[model samples]
Target: MTIDSDADADRERLRELIDELAVVRGRVTLSSGREADYYIDLRRITLHHEASRLVGRVMLRMLDEAGIGCAAVGGLTMGADPVATAIMHAAGAEDRAVDAFVVRKAQKSYGMGRQVEGPSVEGRRVVVLEDTSTTGGSALTAVEGVRAAGGEVEAVAVLVDRDTGAAEHIRETAGVPYLYAYSKSDFGLE
Candidate 1:
């Protein structure tokens, strides 16, 4: 498949910016109950106005390239929130009209008591997003929630895959394809 040079350039630029602004060297514990010598705090870039816009465009392009015409983009909250929203906005700008949903770690006790919130994904194809994945636990959790809510998980996309068996695990456990926009090595971190 041929990729547009402009889009390729944009992806390269976004990658460089993320490496400069988000990658850090330090000891940190990840949400997946793992420890790492370095960390990729994508929030630094995902929260920035211009960087966020770039992320949205790049991600939308990726989905297009992958031929995943999902009805929605979503994943566990906190991390996936901005990414999904960005993807949704980008898709809308392209007239694709994809919505964004967030999966709560636990269903709310009051009101709707819902786990998946946004547009109803029942019988719709969806893509799960994550900022960074180590064990794929969080992504899989979102997958389970989405499935329980009657959505078909077409794929899972993580901003950064830690290469710690997340992709393999997600596929093996849930039978869903996994793709990462970037990986730890993209930031020069081993």
Candidate 2:
């Protein structure tokens, strides 16, 4: 898919911002129980006002370019909230009108009692999102939840891919497109 020169330039600038503000080097344990010499705290950028806008723009552009039609964008709560909200607002600003949803780690035993909150995803095409991907565990949870709720997972998008084979895992397991805005090497990691 072709991107406009202006959007491409913005993407480059966003990459610089992410590399400068998000990537950190040190021994750390990831959510997937893996040890790494460097960690990517994408929330540092995904939560930033300006950075979030750029992220939304880039991600939405990617969805548009890929020609994937979806009724909504969503994923597990916390990390996916900002990305999905940003995408929803950005799409609204452009008159695209996509909805957003948040998936709970566990179902609440109350009113609605649903695992996914927000608009109904049943029978809808949805894209799962994440702030950062390590082993694809969280994204997989989201994908499974969406499917179990009768939503078709159109794809998975992440702010950063640790290049640890999660993308392949997601594709093999979910049989859906996997996309990321950046990778470990994007921040000069090995």
Candidate 3:
């Protein structure tokens, strides 16, 4: 298949896998505390190899669509780590090079007192990524770290949005567009 066709297939497969893996239920108190009837725990799929590959494809497609020049793809550590690694690998496979950074929840007491690790982001374009977003606080925290380190955040992307107004919050607070691969409706929860 052509590259475009392959990317499309990957995106479709990723969506299908997400639909299958996501648990749809009621009474889940989301991070936003709006009482969501469903949740998309992307970690269920993100930790799986096949799902991670598909997710990487989808993210790369999004980056291309956004037309933003990203020097690095990163966000708050732990959850964002694997997703960022997948995107970086996919970019390498596609012959597009991009760096990845990690933002710690707390500044390290040692080792240069670093909050953002990996490639230095100074004066470079960046895209903050997350596995899931509810209130968008964690993602915004990473954005703040990137900015403090002199990285220009071009956009933010999440694997799933829990319908907690995070997208709007990020837009209003950070003035950056937020994108999601799937929502509660995609998993038949809405």
* lDDT per residue (tens digit) for residues 1-190 in model 1: 3558867887898898888898889999987778999888899988988788888988888877888779999999989999999998888887888999999998899999999999998999999999889999999999999999999999999888899999999999989889888888878888
Model 2: per-residue lDDT, tens digit, 74-180? Answer: 89988888999888987988898799999998877999788988999999999999988888888999998888888999999987888999999999999999998
lDDT of 3 by residue, 50-139 (tens): 998888878978878878669799999988988898889888888998888999987889979999999999999999999988889999
Model 1, runs deviating above 4 Å: 1-3
Worst 10 residues of 1 by lDDT: 1-10
Relative to the true structure, candidate 1 reaches a TM of 0.95
Candidate 3 local lDDT, residue 64: 85
- TM-score, one value per model: 0.95, 0.95, 0.92
User: Which structure is stronger by lDDT: 1 or 2?
Assistant: 1
Runs in model 2 deviating more than 4 A are 1-3
Local error of candidate 2 at residue 88 (angstroms): 0.8
* Candidate 1 displacement at residue 18 in angstroms: 0.9
